[model samples]
Target chain A: MSTRSPTPVFLDTLRHVETPEGIELSLRVAGPVARVLAWSMDSLIRYGALWVLLMVLAMLGEGGMGLWLIALFLTEWFYPALFEVYAGGATPGKKALGLKVIHANGTPVDWPGALIRNLLRAVDFLPLLYGFGLVAMLCNRNFQRLGDLAAGTMVIYRDPAAAMPQLPPGRALPPPFPLNTAEQQLLIDFAERSTTLNPERQAELADLLARQTGLYGVAGVERLCAHARWLAGEPT
Target chain B: MPLETIAAELRRRNAWEATDLGMVMVRQWLGSIYAAWFTVALPLFMLLHLVCWGHWWLAPWLMWWLKPLLDRPPLYILSYALFGDPPDRRQFWRALPGLLLRRQAFAALTWRRLDVARSFTLPVTQLEGLAGKVRRQRLRDLSYPSRGAAIWLTVVGLHLEIALDFALIALVWMLTPDFIALEFFDLLDDSSQWGQLWLNVVGFCGLSLVEPFYVAAGFTLYLNRRAWLEAWDLELGFRKMAARLAPAGRVAAGLAMLALGLGLLMIPLENFAAEAPSRSNPPPPAIEESLMNPLCEQRRVREVELAQAGSSIKQALAETLKEPELHVCQVQERWRWRDDNSTESPPRSPPDPRPGQWFAATIELLLWLAVGLFIAVAGWWLWRRTPRAFTRARQRAAQSGPRLVQGRNEITIPPDAGLGDTAWRLWTEGQPREALRLLYQGSLAGLAAQHGLPVRSSATEDDCLRLAVAQLANPELLGFLRRLTRAWQAIAYAHRIPDEADARSLCLEWPRHFAAAGALPA
Candidate 1:
């Protein structure tokens, strides 16, 4: 577990969390742009709802004004907390953007965590327009704002599991030589992403493994795809 | 540039993630990027302000308009930095002019000044050196997918700049003392030279912080788009695979060449034997033919066998594909109402409101009742505590006299007797527990009376030790107190008596710790 390289092996936004269940979950932390957009959308919804309520409440005079004030207080403070806790860790805006708030340990946020983060929004909004919060987010590796840092929560992009690519119709054939798991996965990924590459590029890529496959050019590509199919457990 | 040396891990990323990568890039190279930025920007800002002496407002606008020019140095630094070769101060200065003046600088500051995706497209001209129609076509292709994010980046950048500017002003206003009475509105509307100069300084500060991030984000977005369009990750993977196999491929080729060379050498030797007829008798016709073309017959047989195997394998594959598991079609059964029921029996009517209204009214009434009950309970509790609160002050006043209580025992020390001398006498008389108790009680009383430690009468040995730790400045005194308390607790609770030497040491050390604080006046 301590065999970390001095420099990172690869750089990407994907954060890997290992659960006690012995599974590694890869989460992509959403950056500031998407978060800001989602926040603006939430603000629009919150205030837009409040404005409509105010209009209806104004017709009822003083009592309506008091009720509108209470609605304003709730929307300003508890709106995000309630939605985040109950709505599978997403507010309506976050859901629209396919983002969710979760604990730093990759668990669903509980009531206290949700309330603490939302309450600290007042501090994150210091000076004006979340200026301090933006700076904090930019500085943090996880892109967590001050509220998020305090509450031990983070916003991650909720990516669904990608479906397997449909392989081209071909007879499954085992590779001439044995392949390790990484090499086998590479072959499978090549078949998966080959549709996006040009035929010449595909042939070029396959030509790299030509020595192993005992083939070259288009024939090499077909052989690798066949190997990929076999590795994927297609009946051979 | 070699892909392996690129600092950032490149993959297919959306525009926002690419921008985030740029943010990470800026963080990684923050010191160098800022040094590059301020090295040119600060001088340019001062020069512009100096030139526009009285018209200070024009300088900031000019500086803002020259952002494309200002943005190049950091971009230049980052472009090299991305490939892990960050330019030094010398290289940065040397590259500054080319970056500022080259690549359609005139168009950027003029018609293209308002380009919302300026940072995103800036790299097309500056880094790639594309220009004219070629530059336009490249940018159109790159920006096609990411233009919206790039525009939003600019929009967010603009807002951030304004927000920071006002935040700085607000911070200054807030830090001002109340007696000074500085007006916020006056600060904004001030037309004086100092005010205008202050605004310029704040604006420049904001740009200095945000411009590097803006440039880096755009650069990464451009990089991301290229990586996606060209499939650079796959190319890198292929390069890696080729490198890994290069040695094996060379060895196999060498071995094959050696085998062919040996076979060629054998061919002549065999033919010579057939020609010379060196054997006692002429070789058989079969042997002669086999020697003449040693590999031809074996190769033909192997090829024919392989062709047969290939056809059989194909036949098996085709047969396997016909299996039921390979062509599974799931049939899902779900109950649904018939689509055509003539008029759906009867037209749907509005829901009855009476039950729903009554339920809602009941909920509202329950909520009101809960609130009222809470208030009533709080009032009764306060009413019950009012009389006790008034008498508690009198009780506190009545209990002001000093009293020394050790554990559950009260020790009344004679006013004139030396506490250490009396405890020593008690120890010698076979009353170790009582002697230890007297030492403990006297130490607490001394701490409270002489050293002004607020030792409570009910404080246990642990509590006394804690208070002494907090209040005592002398280590020797604190150490003495710790030893005395431990000896006392051993005899009092654990019923373990101390050794004679230990008992004598405590009696001697007690005065040094407690009596030195004027616990006993000689």
Candidate 2:
């Protein structure tokens, strides 16, 4: 739906979606690397499950092979799609990786999209080892393969599990300029990342922002830090 | 007054870090790179694909990897645009080869995170021009934040490209209604060789559409990173404030300096008096009192006059030593190899470089970079111009007109065009000016040649009718020619569109009229 314009628009994986209730939600798209890692975890789990079930069913002798084929078909074809559609858009592996499948618009993944995307695994595995699928992912912006394209779906990172960072002891101050969503994000990010930065470097960055605040040198750095604290909603 | 002289050229000189918002940079340059992507790279890719044999997949896959090549163009173009020297279409074409996918083509494909890191790399590689250790340090400093957004850009861009690719294929499929029909669709398998190839081509086209944007977004992220690094927003804000306050600042400075000057002048001479000459000192030795007194220090106590018979003692003291005249000359000499560009010593020539020397060779590193960059540039040159290099094909294209196409349409005009031929040529070329000229010219030529109308080159449509309207008597031709003239005159002079249906209908009638005029075959 977004491809109407011949003028190419920059689409960030970071999607800011508004709910009907007017609450905003930000979602990050998972890249091929993370998705692949999650898929590997899922595959390993499936492999273990197959081994355990086969070992148990071996006691039943001749019937085990026939039953195992049914199990294999079900596990291989339906496992991911079923889990994704039913279990918050994640398979066991995706859950572990803190990833989930969603519609391009940041809505929950629907049954058809999951089924279609999962069904296209065969197509992805063409020639060998998800050959065309890997190419598609590498070539694409969102790291979506052929299936994801057809399905109009995306695999995004579930919001980070980490808690909001604590702003260091400082007098809180409002940012001089009205920050849009991106700027707001930048401030919050600065505060979060500042802990890792050395004092001089932190001060250096803060001083750079001094011009905007009409402050100079140390005062500017302190004020910017205060603004970051305020923006992050930290208690002074 | 400062900016007025070089207003368009004016830009705040900033460090690599002190740039504008990434989005601002991206917005400034988005359109240009987009234009270049489709206008420059797409057709080149298509031509490359056409020339490629058997290995049908090679072009598409190469296109996949070669997109990183485009990342540089946006950076180069953006680098220019940011500094207030945005390249025009022609300039961009000229500059495209040197900067296009210069060195990082293979690395772009091979690295796992290189796709994600491209935006970060643009600044490290291009903007800072940092190399070796310093470059690495800069990259490290820039990597985290840039890499985060870079990942996002890659991911979202990919998804967008995929969606777009799908849409393009769908659009193509929908364009041909017969392809959608059940019987025809069933007959033509999509998995077949040609079918898949066409589909891949469509996919490539779709990918091409979104790739420039992907590069643009990466560029934006990079710009943003640099902005973050340099505090560009603050710097720009400061620059703008300074510019605004400049007139007032100068006045304030002048006033302060004037106040200080006045304050200095108003001080009393007595308060700035010299030390007391007679500090309780009575007359002592002949010259002792004079040395101690301020009044005597500046004043002559006794005057010695020089007589004609005898020279003064001061002159006699100066004549005791002779003054030596000084002379200096700049000495320069050239040896055998002084005029040469070669780096050599004796018969052994240049000494063998040690492994440690290789690492420290900044000059050599730069030289190699240049060579690699040149080769890449040469590749792009060949890519864009290689087809034209074929003399045989150039002649064929001459009859067919410019083979450079925007879309699936291979429309061309004849190189050596005639009246009717020229109009068709112009129409095909999408050149309204030339097309319309030929259209009118062809119509006039038809009127004169077919009918016994006295149409001169200088004659107006009115004059033609007045001279031979009765002789011509064909109202359709007369009406057609008049309408053509009005349309032409409107576009040529007033720059207005005549009634669309009327012009189109006239254009449609052109062939028939030409045939009637015996200007063309029926």
Evaluate chain B of model 1: give its TM-score: 0.48
Among the numbered candidates, top DockQ falls to 1
**Tens digits of lDDT, candidate 2, B370-464:** 99999999998987787566765545543332232112333333222244555645555666655666566555445544554544434565675
lDDT of all the models against the reference?
Answer: 0.78, 0.59
For residue B194, model 1's alpha carbon misses the true position, in angstroms, by: 1.1
Estimated TM-score per prediction? 0.62, 0.40
Docking class of 2: incorrect
Residue B100 of model 2 has an lDDT of: 59
Scoring only chain A, what TM-score does candidate 1 earn?
0.90
lDDT by residue (A1-236, candidate 1, tens digit) is 11112463335677789999999998778878778888889999999999999999999999999999999999999999999999999999999878899998899988988999999998888776787888898899899999999999999988766887678779898765545466677788788778777889888888877767778989988888998899888889
